[model samples]
Target: MVQMIFLFAILALMTIVLMEANTVSARDCLSGTFGGPCWAWSGEKCRRLCIEERHVSGHCSGGMKCWCEGC
Candidate 1:
């Protein structure tokens, strides 16, 4: 029973870590200058420039830039 509990605890920890590493928010895009839309990725911030020849969605807040897909 103790071993099972330990295993479960480890699994839970791994799950939590993975989730955090993969977690990302749209705010990252609006974090700094660029003052333009961007594509956010898991464990990564928005890209500096648009990848495709498409209109990205973004906003400028407090002189900062924020962006998201299909914004």
Candidate 2:
């Protein structure tokens, strides 16, 4: 009986944690990347575009792409 209770508690905690991780109002995990060096723009410029598009985080990737996080 005690072992069953402990397992149930663990499972409940895991469910709550996963729910928090996949929040609906804000994307806590979803992310993507896009290649750059197009239109005579630098990677930094492309990163700003990602930010403008509402990414939670954005960065220039190795002078060739824009990497962004959040949705």
Candidate 3:
């Protein structure tokens, strides 16, 4: 019973955290393929583009994909 209560409390805390996170800002994610140099499509580059587009952050992923994130 004690363990169950603790688990429930942890779950509740996690739920609250997630909810607060969503309330902070909603992000719009855009992903696209690039054929340029790897450095040209780096995570920092994508992040900068996102920032220019008034976004929060961004990253370059596998398969030469650039993920731009905005709020």
Candidate 4:
């Protein structure tokens, strides 16, 4: 019974922590594809283009797509 209560208390604390952590302010960013396709796309290149050209943050995501986030 004591162990169960301890476990429950820990779980409740974790839940509260997670809830607080999840309440972060999200950026209102615009997302779109960068270049042609994933075949010749690199993270550095994409990030550079996004930062320099579009003035935003960018990354090469899955499926060979360069995702750019503009605020």
Identify the leading candidate in terms of TM-score.
3
lDDT of 4 by residue, 1-71 (tens): 99999999999988876764443225322235455763343767777766865656666443455555555
In model 2, the worst 10-residue window by lDDT is 23-32
Worst 10 residues of 3 by lDDT: 32-41
Q: lDDT for every model?
A: 0.42, 0.53, 0.59, 0.58
- TM-score, per-candidate, Cα-based: 0.35, 0.35, 0.41, 0.41
Q: Write the per-residue lDDT of candidate 1 for residues 1-71, one digit (tens) a residue.
A: 99999999999988876664443344334333343433233212333232231325432222223443442
Runs in model 3 with CA error above 4 Å? 1-28, 31-41
Clashing pairs in 2: none
Error of 4 at 52 (Å): 2.2
Per residue, candidate 3 scores C-alpha lDDT tens digits across 1-71 of 99999999999988866664453233545544323643433767777776776666766544344556665
Candidate 1 residue runs with Cα over 4 Å from true position: 25-71
Candidate 4 regions exceeding 4 Å error are 1-34, 39-41
lDDT of 3 at 29: 57
Give the residue spans of candidate 2 off by over 4 A: 24-71
The true-versus-predicted C-alpha distance at residue 70 of model 2, in Å, is 9.3
Cα lDDT over the full model 3: 0.59
